[model samples]
Each structure stands twice: as structure tokens, then as C-alpha cells.
Target: MADLFVSETQLPVEVRTHEALSTEELMVFGQSGVKEFEIARRFEAGRAGFPQSDECALAFFEISGRTRTVIREDRLAGGAGQPITYLGFPPARAAARRLTGQGVVSANSETTCLSRVDRAA
Candidate 1:
């Protein structure tokens, strides 16, 4: 299984790869531990709008390293708009290639959970 790590500094721009189309088993890792799957964006979620907020963050999912899925924890109303926190699937290194034309950086082997979204904040 391919595994990678992205820091808060390397803001996610786009996800270009995925493991499989099956959502039967998917888990999102975040600071709060296992995060419930809120909603899956369009299959071509990558083609959607780019995360315009600088406050965007990065999240790691402990699923197939093949599926490079991207999920965002929305921000709360009236609060400072934060960057779209993206939950990248396993082996998210491909994101670099899509985000930037340059090659993807080696991610940390350790997989850290994503921070919980403060929608009520």
C-alpha cells in the first residue's frame, strides 16, 4: 500500500489519482480520530473549483493507497473563511503533480489524522 504525508504548509490544490470507485470501505483520519464521511463530491471533484481560501488544510485518509480521493471539511458561517481542508486518500503524492506542474514531494511515512471541521464556530 502506498503511503504519503503532506504538511499544513503544502496546501492542496487538486487531487489527480484514486484507488478505486468503490466506497464500501472508506475512513478519514483526522486530529479527532476517525471522521464520519460527510459527503462525496462529484466523481470528478478535482475538476471542480480550486480551493480559493488560504486557510485550507490537509487531511489524511487510511484507505486504499490507490484511491486518491479529496474531501473538504466546510467552514462555519460568519467565521473567517478558512482554506478548504482536503482529505486525501492513500498515496496522495499524486496531488502534487496535479496541483503543480512540478513533481510530487516525498510525503512523510506517518499518516496523521485531519483536524475536525468547526462548522458551528
Candidate 2:
């Protein structure tokens, strides 16, 4: 399975290429060795009315024959969106993550935003 490793600080994307392991495997060398910490930080920030920056640095790694290679690196900018007015239900977060992942995978040119609005029943 493909895994994504994210860090607030820069990751050594170049040097890591020589290691014969997937990004998930490399996690064992880190302090936490778990990716959930970053996910939690994002959720916590959202809960506290702080939205994450729209920009992200992404590096795609893939296996070519017997070696893993960094195929592409790019910045994902979601652009500015309206301020978060109301927090949606728990499922909203999952939906947001799914949509964002799709954007990253497709390298979409357009930005998408999610907002919650209550309508009369």
C-alpha cells in the first residue's frame, strides 16, 4: 500500500530515495512512528477555528522495477475560501479528507471548498 508522510518541516525527499523502503516503512525511524499525530493536529486546528494553510508540498514516490523513485513534486494550493462558520458533523471531516485526496491525486486545477448550511426541513 502507498503511504504518505507529511511534516511541518521539510522532509529529506531526495536522500530517502536511496532507502529500500516505502514511506510507511521509514516511519519506524521517526520519534512517533505514527502518522496520526499530523492528522490530529489538523483536526484540532479546525476545531479551534484555525484553518490550515492552503498550500502543501507533495512528492510522489513510485516503484520503478526494483527501485522506488520520486516521480513528481508539486505544490497544492487550495486558494482562499470563506471562513469556517459552522462545524459540520463528524462525517464532514472524512468527506473533506476524501475530496482533498482526490484533488491531490488528480492534480486538479480548480479549488474546492466545503461549507455547511442548514435548510428548513
Candidate 3:
């Protein structure tokens, strides 16, 4: 099983990486004895018409070798017609943990559920 951790912050990328790494290392190593891991963050894209910038911290670590069957679907928008649903191959649903200053956040698998939006032609 692979674990993913996310943190929302306004700190610079470098500083955020260091902070998240320090926190994740301690938590993961202490709980599961994981030493090897990777940390990533999105870099600023210097382009026009880009939305507001929000920095985030992410960490990926190995927990165990486990596999599961699941389906992920997304709707594709195109010409004036019924939307098409794309089915993703059953992927290895990973178990993840998120660390927060106070404590772990809610662990419900589904974060947000959205209903289809209809636009009149």
C-alpha cells in the first residue's frame, strides 16, 4: 500500500518541503518504520491568465504491497450532446494518511460528491 499526505500552506516551496518532510518522516517512521519516501509540490507557472497561486505540500511513501479493484469515472465535455463518461482501469487503491497540526482530518474515502450541471442551449 502506498500512502499520500497533503498539507495546505502559504509558505515557500522550499520551506514547505522541509517542514512537511520533517513531519512526515517522524510520523511514518515512528508508526510504520518507513525510511524511503518522496515529497513533491507544484511549482509556479509563469504564464498569463493563470489562476491565483496556492502552494501545497505532498508526500508519498510506501506502506506495503497490496492491491484492490476499483473503478474511477470522469465525464468528458464536448459538442452539444450528452456528456461521455470515461472509465479508468481498476487501479491500486492506495491507503493514505494526512497529518495536521491538531490531528488527522476526517478519513471518509469520498471527499466531495458533485451532481451534473445542466446548461440550457
Question: All models: lDDT?
Answer: 0.27, 0.27, 0.22
Off by over 4 Å in 1: 1-65, 68-96, 100-113, 116-121
TM value for model 2: 0.17
Give lDDT tens digits, candidate 2, residues 16-54: 342333333433542221122222232223422223322
Q: Using TM-score as the measure, name the better of candidate 2 and candidate 3.
A: 2
Best by TM-score: 1
| Regions of candidate 2 where Cα sits further than 4 Å from its true position | 1-30, 43-51, 54-100, 104-121
Q: lDDT by residue for model 1 over 1-121, one digit each (tens)?
A: 1113544333222331222222322233221212211111211132122222211212222222233343443346634444443344433334323323333232233222112222222
Poorest 10 consecutive residues of model 2 by lDDT?
57-66
Query: Between prediction 1 and prediction 2, which has the larger TM-score?
Result: 1
What's the TM-score of each model vs. the native?
A: 0.19, 0.17, 0.15
